[model samples]
Target: MTSVDQPPAFSDGAAVIELLNTSIGYGARAVVDDVSLRIDRGEVVALVGPNGSGKTTIVRGLLGLAPVVGGEVRLFGVPAGRFHERWRIGYVPQRHTVVGAVPSTVQEVVASGRLARRRWWKPPTAADRAVVSRAIDVVGLVDQSRASVSTLSGGQQRRVLIARALAADPEVLVMDEPTAGVDVASAEALTRTLARLVEDGRTLLIVTHDVAPLAPILTRVVAVAGGSVVGDEPARIALSPASALAGGIYAHPGHDPHHLAPDDPAGPAPGPGWLGDPGLRGAPAAS
Candidate 1:
């Protein structure tokens, strides 16, 4: 396993992410209602659910991508809206998010993750270059670092996106459908990568349909169905052979909730430059 540098210390027994009786949705419709969850430092939490079951909404709700209509949302013990240390939280969107008409090299794409933390006027230092290189190497894409992102396959692109998130060295890594559409080999590679990250003491919030690849390292499972948490189990119990026989740990169909249609009236409009991320520069104002 590749070694991640020593991570910044986190307060013991404190929640990295907390949602208390939270309600998240677009405008009038509530996708996730009264969903309360707490993710502690170094914990790997999996959010499993069916399509349109509010799993993605919950993730977005925490990121301030979705509307938090009610209850409380906090990150690092601070209210989500007031939290400004966004560079500490890394987000890997679906593979399609980075695909666009403007082609960028794998190195360039991964480097974007550092923008929030980097000074706008200063050039990248040796430390920055080193971190970026490590991120690429960890994803086993060092040879393709200089290649165009458009030239890579879908799985390769996903790995690049993951490398980008890792470049940020976030305390909490949030991934949506991380293994979706990847081949078995790529999936296994990602599994190992994630295990290494967990071993390095990084907190993870993963939203996916297949938990088999991640079951071993997962500390807790938060199953959502019908826009609510239906089951929460420990990894030992959830990954047991008996559990597989009794209806597997993961449910089918974890619909990607990040994509909000242009005409969707009830959904969140997006946040404006929230968390110092330029991509979200036009998102809706905080509630």
Candidate 2:
């Protein structure tokens, strides 16, 4: 077990994610074991671990994306299967994956985030339009709202994704590797935005490798290994003042022991391109 300086502060009130007797696997093979964990409202919790540590699996289970072999998950206090609070949760995927290289305008794409709140087979209402506009403004994309997502710079595309998530005005924001691909400047900027979310009373859960750059701004950090939580602590006390914050690129003895950095001229830049990473196929732990 990893050492911790102090106990976690569990004061956000009401659980947003709960994994009870939760176990997940592929083809009857269990990768993550029975586990029970809860994330509270208004909390910013960071999930960290080595490769094949079950980070993505847990995320998928919480989102109801993958089947649960046993146990149950609850979102916003609702049973996982019956949970319909998607609009209350926002997700920022590692991939900028989208249809076509044709590129869609930032506003158009951000508007998609509100689809969950809309009724089935119905068009966007005036309220939806206002929400989208507010979301775009929050992410500082008002000027670039007309820009094409594909044509915009990498950081801009990321902002577009953030805007999409914010369009729902979600209560909790879940991000997987939110800072993996961008440059130092862009990544730092994104971190600032996340910090703002906490300041605004919105909860956030992020899976990350490093705690620096953004560490000084985080509320808590939870480490996972072998599919279970090894440590959960207050950011102010847990991480060493001198500890390295993982970012830019991680060529861990992890998911990709030899994973190349995005700047690898021969390698693909961060975004959808990483989806094709063969290293990840063998290293599900890193996700």
Superposing all C-alpha atoms, what RMSD in Å does each candidate have to the true structure? 13.1, 9.4
Best by lDDT: 1
In model 2, the Cα lDDT at residue 142 comes to 74
Task: Give a tens-digit lDDT track for model 2, residues 45-76.
Answer: 77777757888778877876677887878787
Give the whole-model CA lDDT for all candidates, comma-separated. 0.72, 0.67
TM per candidate comes to: 0.81, 0.78
Instruction: Output the worst ten-in-a-row residue range by lDDT, candidate 2.
Output: 278-287
Backbone clash numbers for all candidates listed: 9, 6
Clashing pairs in 2: 51-285, 51-286, 52-285, 53-285, 210-246, 212-245
Give the Å error, residue 167, model 1. 1.4
Could you tell me how far off, in angstroms, the CA of residue 139 lies in candidate 2 after the best superposition?
1.8
Residue 264 lDDT in candidate 1: 33
What global local distance difference test value does model 2 have? 0.67
